[model samples]
Target: MAKTFASQGDLAEKHTSFTEVGDGVYAFTAEGDPNSGVIIGDESVMVIEAQATPRLARKVIDCVRSVTDKPISHLVLTHYHAVRVLGASAYGAPQVIMSDAARAMVVERGQEDWDSEFGRFPRLFQGHEEIPGLTWPTTTFSDSMTVYLGKRRVDIMQLGRAHTAGDAVVWLPDAEVMFTGDIVEYHSACYCGDGHFADWAGTLANIAGFEPVAIAPGRGDALLGRARVAEAIANTADFVESTYRPVAKVAARGGSLKEAWDSARAVCDPKFGAYAIYEHCLPFNIARAYDEARGIDTPRIWTAERDREMWAALQG
Candidate 1:
């Protein structure tokens, strides 16, 4: 029989744990899956990154229920990815926040992304019927916005584009913890399907200024201490560097995207072999890296049809 996905036979569903990173800061992680961060303020709460579906998002709510009774007022999307934003309706956080660029991306390519991603990873969206529609952010900012969770300060800064053109980080200066959305994937592979390589590196440097002692990355274990935090950033940077350099080098030499893919595969296939979705991501990674190397700052929309065409053109 073919292997199954999403449903982990190891652990029954509805097992969400709220891990306290600091006094009021918590991370809601499901059995080794994508993580969501919660910041409890003087009154209300702020949630970062909605899961795949409303039903899946409720799992985070169940985790939050274990901690406190504060009502969640804001839902912040780190980027415009379908897996991260589709579950917004579950929270009903009043204000769904994202970068202006992210909102624009949703307008431009969200439907295509929905189809493409749902096709790519069926397990993530286990309860697909629960998804009402494409998630839209009612409140958006071009660069930054500071939300007062009663009295606590949460700074939303869009330093530079990395994972996506509108990628942003949730930073708590006093606590010195930042929720880097897919910017620092620990165990999972960085999905460079719509990434900007050079800008991503610059974004990493920009994040360094805050010097977050604890970081809740888009995936993997939340870093509870400083050293592990730095390790996460360094590891992310190394992966980004390794993936892009070969692609750029090949593209600069007038080689085709196919050649770039092969060269990048030679380097990444062995090193990043263990990371989840490494194979599924390589073709898109090579495509984006090649485009950036050729001076394309903004990545093009990735429709489901375009997905297969690109895959076949580059690898098939």
Candidate 2:
């Protein structure tokens, strides 16, 4: 299984960075692991994207304590991914929020995803046992909602779908800063196993319309300037298109999944090989792209058994 998931052997710890992207906005990023954002309001704080487990969540809590003692009033999850929402219990925030579509996903395949992700990458779930169970949202919105942290007005909106069906972005109108869950990544592979390839570019356009000065992306470094923000958005769009186009072409030609995989590598490796999680996400991305090209509107649920089966079949 030479083409097995690289994350299986990626157990080394990544160095974490806490960067302030706005007046009271912070991005807690670990090398290229899942990132979390903190917004300190006049009276309380709001956190975006909980880590994989309570143990991991505590690391974010530590960073919040370093700057302010304000209690965490809300924990906003960008999607229903296990690594993003399973740590919700740790926050103890009275209001846990997500998009209404995200909540339906949690009820649909949340457990399977938790099992699949835990089996695929154990390093992220450092304290798996501490996870109470599947995380649920106390509050949900259809399209948009606003939460005020004293004077700081944070707008949470489901701006189309890219990484997942229910991707949400946290925006600060005053600071022109946004916390984009996984809709955008900086120098990190965009995992598209459950993504909407066709709508991804449109979503990028929506985010670009806001002209954010800074962004705390789902992974990688915090974008601090308009130049960097623009670059990341453009690069993310490029990555999504690059992965989908080649694989889609292969499928349109009636090629097998393995053939589609080869086509994707031929185009992507030279351009994105240096990115974090590039290898780990390649097989899944290609599989989904192939499916989408074949008119699979909804992505099939990924289970632990299916993960192994696909890896074995894709093995070179």
Regions of candidate 2 where Cα sits further than 4 Å from its true position? 1-6
Residue 296 local lDDT, model 1: 89
Q: List the lowest-lDDT window of 10 residues for candidate 2.
A: 1-10
Q: How accurate is candidate 1 locally (lDDT)?
A: 0.83
At residue 97, candidate 1 shows an lDDT of 94
| Residue runs of model 1 more than 4 Å from their true location after superposition | 1-17
- The backbone clash count of each candidate, in order, is 0, 0
TM-score of each candidate structure, all chains considered together? 0.92, 0.98
- Residue 174 of model 2 has an lDDT of 86
Candidate 2 lDDT by residue in tens digits, 1-316 = 2344648788899999999998988999998999999999999999998899999999999999999999999999999999898888888855899999999999899999999999888999988988989999999999999998888899999999899999999999988999999999999999999999999999999999999999999889999899999999999999999999999898988999999888888889999999999888888898899999999988999999998888877865
Measured with C-alpha atoms, the lDDT of residue 121 in candidate 2 is 84
